[model samples]
Target: MKFKDYYQALGLERGASEADIKKAYRKLAHQYHPDVSKDPQGEEKFKALAEAYATLKDPEKRAAYDNLGQRSSGEQFTPPPDWQQRYKTDAAGFDDVDLADIFAAFSQAGGRQRQDMPRPGQDYEIAAWVTLEQIFRGGEIEVGAELPEYDQNGLPHRVAHVFKITIPNGAADGQRLRLAGQGGHGVNGGRAGDLYVVLAVQPHPLYRVSGRDLYLDLPLAPWEAVLGGNIEIPTLAGPVALNIKPGTLAGQKLRLAKRGLGNRDGSTGALYAVVRIDVPNQVSPREQVLYEQLAANSTFQPRAHFATGAGA
Candidate 1:
C-alpha cells in the first residue's frame, strides 16, 4: 500500500488543533466544491478533502491514522501488525485498497453517524420593486422569487415562492429586509436560512428621490414667478399648497418640510419643489398691445451684460 498524507491533503500541520482543522476544511471545501468551482479537478480535490476531514475530525480515527507514523506521501509502505489488532479488524490483502476506503469502513461500522448531523439551509437574496407610495404608507407588498429547494433525495432544484412582505416606512432604495426561516429548507432538523428582500424603488414619472427627500418639477407661469403666489402641488401623501417667492429663478428648489418619505426614526424627509418658469406660446391681441407698450416704455436692459466687458 502507498502512504497518503491526510495533513498535507488538507494543507495543515500534523499538530493542527481541531478548530484549525475545521476552519481549513471549510475554506478548502468552499473553494473546491464541484457545484460552484470552475476548476476541472475540483470534484476530485473535494473528495480528497472530504476524506481527509472525515478522518481528522474524529479523535479515534485521527489517533489510529497517526499511529501509522510519518512517511513520504505515495511511498510504498505497510501498516504495522499492531494496527489490525488495535482497530480489532482482520483483513487480508491490504494492497490495492484505497486509504479512503480504510477509514470509510470505520465510519460505516459506526452507523453512518455524520449523515445524521443537522445542517443549516442556504440563505437567499432577491429583489422586489416597490413604489414611492408604498414606502410612504408602509404596507404589505407581494413578492415572487425563484429559490433553490432540496428534494427528498437532497438534490437542489429551483422553486418559485410568493411572499407577502411589508414595506417599511421610509424604506430607501436598495434596502434589504430580512425574513427569517424563509430560505432553503434545512436538513436533519436544522434551522432554515433567512431570505433578504432587496427593495428596488420603481421610477416615478413626476418625482425623483435622493435618500428620503422627494423632488418634483413645479411649473410656474411667468407671472407667478415674477409676482409670487401660492400654488397647489402633489406629494406622496396628498396635495399641499406651496408658496413661490417673487423673482424666483428657474431650477430653484423650494423646500417643504416633513412632506417627503417617512423615516424609520419617526422623522420625515423634505420635499423640494423645483421651479420651472413657463410662458404662454400665443397671446391675444389685447395682450400683445400691452406687451408692446411695456417694451416701448420699459428701460429694463436684460441684455446689458452682453455689451459690457463683464460678459467676457
Candidate 2:
C-alpha cells in the first residue's frame, strides 16, 4: 500500500488556504482536460487532479489523510488484520465517496469477485523514497513493488513488479507519480487498477522539509552571532557565501530566496537558515583568563529582564 498526497495533485501547498485550493483546481482542470490539452496523458492527469481535489476539498477527509503522515511510499505495506475495523466509514449520508473510503474498501475486499458483474482491480498506493537532492535534480528511480494479480474469480496473487519511475524536478513530498495499468490485475477482462507511487523525500541530514521549502540549522560561534560576517552556506546545487548581519540572534532565520525546492511553474522555494549559537565546553587556562576578564569588563546584562518584575 502507498499513500496519496492530495495537496501535490492540485499543485498546492499543504498549508494552502481553501481559496487557493479552489483556484488551483480550476486552473488544472482546464489545462489538463483531454479536450483542452494535447498532452499525451491529459485525461489521466485530469482524473488524478479531480481525485486529489475531492479528498482535499472535504475537511473530514483531509483530516483523516493527515493522520497517516510520512509513511514510506513506492514500497509494499501490509495493513493490519483489523485495518478495516479501525477505519470504518463515519460519513453519514454523504453522497460522494472520498478516496480514503475507496482505499479501505479495497483492503477489505482484497479483489474479491462480486456477483456476476466484471470489476476492475482496485487502485493501489506505494511510497517511493527520494532525497531532497534527487528532487532538485530530476531523475529516475527503480523500486521493487509487490503487485497483485487477480484470478478469474478475483482472488489476488502477488507478483514482484520492478518499477522505474521518473521523478519530476522540484517535486514536493506529497506529489504522486501515477503508473497506469500497473496495479492489481483486472478480473474477467476488466481494466487493471492504476498504481500511484507517492513520492516521499527521505529526511536529509542537513535540511528539513516543509512543503517545498527547506530549512537548515546553521551553527555559529557565540562571537560570530554577536559580530557576524560573510560565511559559506551549502545549497542543493553548490556552496555560496551568505552575509550574516551583525547582531544576529540565535533562532533567528535568514531567508535565501528561491534556493529551496523547485516547482512545476519554474519557481523555487526559499531556504531558511536558522541560527544556532555554539559555546566551547572547555577552554585552556589562557582562554579562561581572557573570558573572565571580558565578563568583568562587559556590562551586557542578559538577565536584566529577569531582574525586572515585569514577568513576575
Candidate 3:
C-alpha cells in the first residue's frame, strides 16, 4: 500500500499537542463532512481525516506511528516485522470509531478478518446550545445534525437531518439528550449507534443564571429608593410589580419567592432583584430648585463618616 502521512493529513507537525490535534481534526471534519460539505471529494477527505485522528488521538497508536519516522507520499510502505505484536491489540475509543469502516477495509484488503461478520456502528456526540427562553417555556427544539449516509452501491455520503427534541423546563447547562439509533450506520445489517446532544444554556443579557436562580439589576431612582413603592420589574414569566421598602440602599437584594426557573418536580427558584440607584446626570431648573430645597431641609447626612474621621 502507498505511504500515508497522518500528520500532513491533519495539517499538523510531528510534535503537535493532543489539543492541537483535536482542534485540527474538528475543523477538518466540519469542512469535509459528507452531509454539509459542498466539495465533491468531501467523503474521501473526511475518511482520511478520520483515520488520521483515530490513529493519532491514542497515545500508544501515536507513539507507534511516530516510531516509523518520516515517509514520502505514493511510496510503497509496510509496517515493522513486530508491528502486529506491538500495536495490534491497541483499541480506539468509542468517540473515534466513526471511521471504523476505513480501518476494517484496510484489514480486509490485507486478508485479516472474516468478511461475513457484521460490525455495529459508532456513537456520536455533539455540543449544542439552547436559549434561556426555550428552557423557561419548555417545548420542542429543532436541532440540525449532520451525519454520514451510504448509497445503494455502499458508497458513503453525508446528509443533514433536523431532529425535534423536547426540552424540559429548567434544563441546566451541561445537560445531555441521548437519541437511540441516530448515529453512524452499521455495517452488514448491524444496528446503528446512538447520538448524544450535550446541551448548554446561552447567556442572557437581562439576567444571570445560576442553577435555578436568576439575578437581575433593578435600577431605581434615588427618590424611589428612599420613598418606596411598587415598581414594575421583568421576570421570565412576564412583567410583575415588586414592592420596595423605604430607605432601600444600593446593592440591596430583594427576593421574589418562587419566581425563578421552574423545576420538573414542581418546585421553582427565587429571583433576586439587586438594587442600583440612579441619579439624573443633567437636572432641569425646577429639579435643581427642588433638590436644593431638599438638601437644605433633609436631615439625611451621607457624609457623616467622613465628618467623624475629619473630627478625629
- Candidate 2 residue-wise lDDT, 1-312, digit = tens: 445677878877778887898899999988998679988578678878887787677665566566656453343343333333443432221222233444423433443446445557668877788888888999888978776554333334466788998887668887887889887665457788899988877879999988778899999987788888999999998998999888899899999999998888888899999999989999999999999999999998877778675652
Cα shift from native, residue 93, model 2 (Å): 47
Which 10-residue span in candidate 3 carries the lowest summed lDDT? 89-98
TM, every model: 0.58, 0.60, 0.66
The global Cα lDDT (0 to 1) of model 3 is 0.77
Whole-model Cα lDDT per candidate? 0.80, 0.73, 0.77
User: TM-score for model 2?
Assistant: 0.60
lDDT, candidate 2, residue 253? 94
Candidate 3 lDDT over 64-100, as tens digits, reads 6687678875555554545333334223211222233
Runs in model 3 lying further than 4 Å from the true structure = 1-52, 55-119, 188-191, 306-312
Tell me the lDDT of model 2 at 220: 95
User: Which segments of candidate 1 are over 4 A away from where they belong?
Assistant: 1-120, 155-158, 187-191, 284-286, 310-312
User: lDDT of candidate 1?
Assistant: 0.80
Tell how far residue 185 is off in model 2, in angstroms. 2.4
Q: Compare the candidates by TM-score and give the number of the best one.
A: 3
Worst 10 residues of 1 by lDDT: 86-95
Top lDDT model: 1
TM-score pick, better of 1 and 2:
2
